[model samples]
Target: MRNMRLAAALALVFILVTTVFLGGCGQKLAVAPQQGGLQGLKKLKVGLVFDVGGRGDKSFNDAAYEGLEKAEKEFGDKIEIKYLEPSAGGENRERLLRLMAQDKYDLIFGVGFIFTDSIAKVAKEFPQIKFGLIDGFVPGLKAENNISCLLFREHEGSFLVGAAAAMQSKTGKIGFVGGMQSPLIEKFETGYIAGAKYINPNIGILSDYIGTASDAFKDPVKGKELTLKQIKDGADVIYHASGASGIGVLEAAASQQKFVIGVDSDQSLPAKEDQRSFVLTSMLKRVDVAVYETIRSLVTQKFQGGYQEFGVQENGVGYAENQYNKELIAANKAKLDELKEKIIMGEIKVPTSKEDLK
Candidate 1:
């Protein structure tokens, strides 16, 4: 009977050991999934709203998207990105921004100045969210702490490209096609005219706007019509800062066998063979670089809110020189380089408005 009791006691001890070991194994399995779940929760959410031309315009909007894409590739699963293109009227812009903010997105960006008012309204309501405005500033917006304005010295870059146009023009007359007549676009117009005059005092400049509204940026029909008008008026080389509308300018230039300068991205890179032949160069606005850097700052917890101005001195803007425009730029390399240095050194002041140009 004592031997039997000893065996039973030994069996009881074995059961207890097995239970403890099995419990530990279960806990280990559960802990791994929980740890992984916690890691997955750490992703940062980002939202972007494109301007009128949207992402495929291969112009300003595409540049912004490129920045987002770059950040996504580098961070991988660490970040979640979403972008929206508002209706042509942009009546949905405010709603889109609010939805993103309500969903607790970490950072949101508005791609054009047209969004300034909408962003300001939503940003005020959601003080916890971070907002970025490109080529746009909401003057006197109360949410200064949560908003950052990214602006560029477009005039400085325009000046460089305009000089190239002047030098490349077969005819003494050139043209400037603008998206709108606002102070913002006026900067581009004045700079182009100033740079042309800097090269040749008597150069004729034919300037026209696609329209008087924000939609002008995407109006290729108007872009083509205006460009044709300029070409008819003896303008052989054209410089356009009209976003997607500039594509039409390129088309017109090619059709007419004239030269053209593009804006924002390296327009020459995406041009068709016919268009490529006429694309002299593009004003590199560095919008993608700016957007990427801003998002990086946010991810690293180093983001600062306020006005951030990028200029030629900051490498924020310049002219693109690629295979399509290499020979053209090479011919004017010395003059263009000299003008760039002068602008950076403050020896040359590129006007930012029609009034300023006067």
Candidate 2:
């Protein structure tokens, strides 16, 4: 009887263990059911492909991430948000985008102008998938129905900061550091110089381009090198249109006891303790607003495609005047507002190219 009882106890333990093990395996294999919204519509899935300087750049890429986060907050479980940062250049972007499409993402966004060609190609291949391309519009592409291009009046905002730099400079010299010498970056240079000259007819403006390649946007060491050169050349104030590379410019300013203007987003918020004090102001490019609006449109089924340009008149670009730099910009507020009015009123033509400035 004792042997029989012991045998029964061992059999029960074995049965319990097998049951628990199979239950665990079952849970692991289970998939969450597809969720729906008010009208039983499926949840929205969004995929974002960030350029080289992804979320932590504290500049352009961060702004885009903010927009995505905003959308996720608003929709909650009704949406799925995913972002991809390419390990390499062009081909990687193409692969990431293609994979997102293959996964049937309801919407996708490419964060920079660098993705223009890759997005154009992938977007055309996936005609049914909605795509948003920031900072660039592919020319001669007929995928307008499915792709939306978001562009900015970077020059207009650059002009405002340029005026501020001219007014605030103690050395009668200011400088511009651009990521590349492309036409897009040239717009920033032209407008900056023009606005500076408009403020002080005799102001000396020094300009430098980081490089001719896309990688220039990510090269801060080179940015620091160029900024030091400009400072040595007597520039007490500088503005940079370079992306992540601009961080170096700000660092150099703090080290050299000069002033630096930020680009894209309000950069003062991300600057280190010492660097924040030297950031005179920033050219506020409303990339975050554009990105959020695009996602909102997709959510509401009101998505529009084709080339869309956001400008000063649309409040798409302007100067940053937060607590970090409000006191610094106060002295130039009246004149800056007047210049802003002229640009919006069509009285002042903000040059978008070097030739236009001439």
Candidate 3:
């Protein structure tokens, strides 16, 4: 009886530990179910932490999710992947990143520029692990082939859509809605302005922002309000880099029957069907491509540290010409391609900052 009781206690302890690790304790880890397991094979473990607006933002974060999904699809047999979403404001981003590093994930990804500092800290602590930072990095900080800064030439892509907006706008007055007030966001804003002015030097462009914080990307109500104000002020076209908040810009466009451009992703698909017609071309930043390439490099043992840029020349950025806005793009495709060639060939330089625009 004593022997049997001891065995039962051990079994119970094992069960409890298993349950907690498998998330029976109420925290669900979206771990991909393994198939055809190699009993002795070592699988690369990967973790990704989302930026503000999380997975369903249908903008930047969603694009990152696509890259994760692609990596899983391509390397499911060789790798295991999991992701976590931060609280609404992303206040605990560093905490979450550090927790993942503490768990010893082999490869981790920080989905936005907000993760620059957090990933830098965690990457340094876990020198053996590789970290991929999207759109952010620690300047001059090297982690011995551990940190890969995945930067994008977002300004070039934004310029394409900005020029498209100028060519198609009926009122000759377009607008821009940015998520936050940062040099990064200014990349989109200044690029858009320069692109528009490149085509129509005398054009009028109205620019507004959702807020001054990360939460700015989550506020669609404010996006709609600002968009409406721009519309009322006689702007006939709008483009937004406000992440989830861009949904409001879409709504405002639908209500007012005005055309709007989208950012990050090919957002025309997610727009309300009725509102889809009014969506102009989108500036495609290829965040999904960047994410996928990072994962691929790691899995293929080609991973290296330092900065990597995704720009038009790299096919890492461009404009979306889809069925929803094929007509507009078709009309401007010639000029758009010309300007794109110029940027790629060094004939026309796109401004990445406001000061450079002059």
Candidate 4:
């Protein structure tokens, strides 16, 4: 981590990447409606930096963008917005954040856990500026009072979908695919296994990860390969916490007409018509709500530093029940909600780590 920081510092000197702007309301990640001019009709100035896969991932990044879009509509001409995506390998996150600080944006947002180190470093230098971090955390970030660590109880939502997968599986076996194989994604895996076991104590679960690095989220080809392997192993239903990579999982499952669960956003909503039927349900992580509320807090002068957590109790995480998956989910909805209530009531403990799952 220290080596990366040194490299980033040097990049800011000999190889800077912070000046790439595309010209728009939110030039970095989006184009907001023009309020006459960038200087005219501005209230709060906001900036956002997307994670590696950028805006079209239709998963984590897309969910965060939804919140930014909502804030733009409600705030109207009263707010100014700008967003940026990192370099191809996501190596310039710190520089982009530092540039935003230099630009004096009122509130800056780093939209994934990958930004924890970058945001924490930058927020300290610009102590007066506020930052919102989705799915990121730092040891002393709370005390800084300039950065909001927006966290989600991802395991809670994952558990619900896991239960759904177990209940719907006819093969008595299921599978889980994760992106980047980190402790964060482990929450998805652990909760999934727990929920599946809760439904059937002896149910077999086959799991795999796209990779150990950030590229894992973008590797759809590898995602498909892993999904197919799981299916061949007798696992009928599958769930994925992968970002864009899960698109391959969805496609692979549909090829065999097996059930699959999605994460972050509703995969079925944007899925191709032919592949849409295979997506059983998605674990709604509610990244949009978190982003919108953080923005709202700033507007309402209620913004505070610390870990801002959202979970099942906060309605920040759950399972999706939409037109495509309504019938399938309805068959198991009653028990799923019962498990949800148990989670919220603290009656059933959902584990976030492999050790805890045991």
TM-score ranking from best to worst? 1, 3, 4, 2
**lDDT to native, each model:** 0.89, 0.88, 0.89, 0.89
| Tens-digit per-residue lDDT, 217-242, candidate 4 | 98889989999999999999999998
lDDT of 2 by residue, 178-256 (tens): 9977988898888899899999989999999999987788889999999999999999999998889998999898899
Q: What is the TM-score of each candidate against the true structure?
A: 0.89, 0.87, 0.88, 0.87
Q: On a 0 to 100 scale, what is the lDDT of residue 66 in model 2?
A: 87
lDDT of 1 by residue, 167-259 (tens): 888789999999977888888888999999899889999999988888899999999999999999999999998999998999998999988
Model 4: colliding residue pairs: 28-83, 28-84, 29-83
User: RMSD in angstroms, all models?
Assistant: 3.7, 9.4, 10.7, 16.6
C-alpha lDDT (0 to 100) for residue 144 of candidate 1: 42
Error of 1 at 352 (Å): 0.8
Model 4 stretches astray by more than 4 angstroms: 1-41
Model 3 bad stretches (over 4 Å): 1-40, 141-143
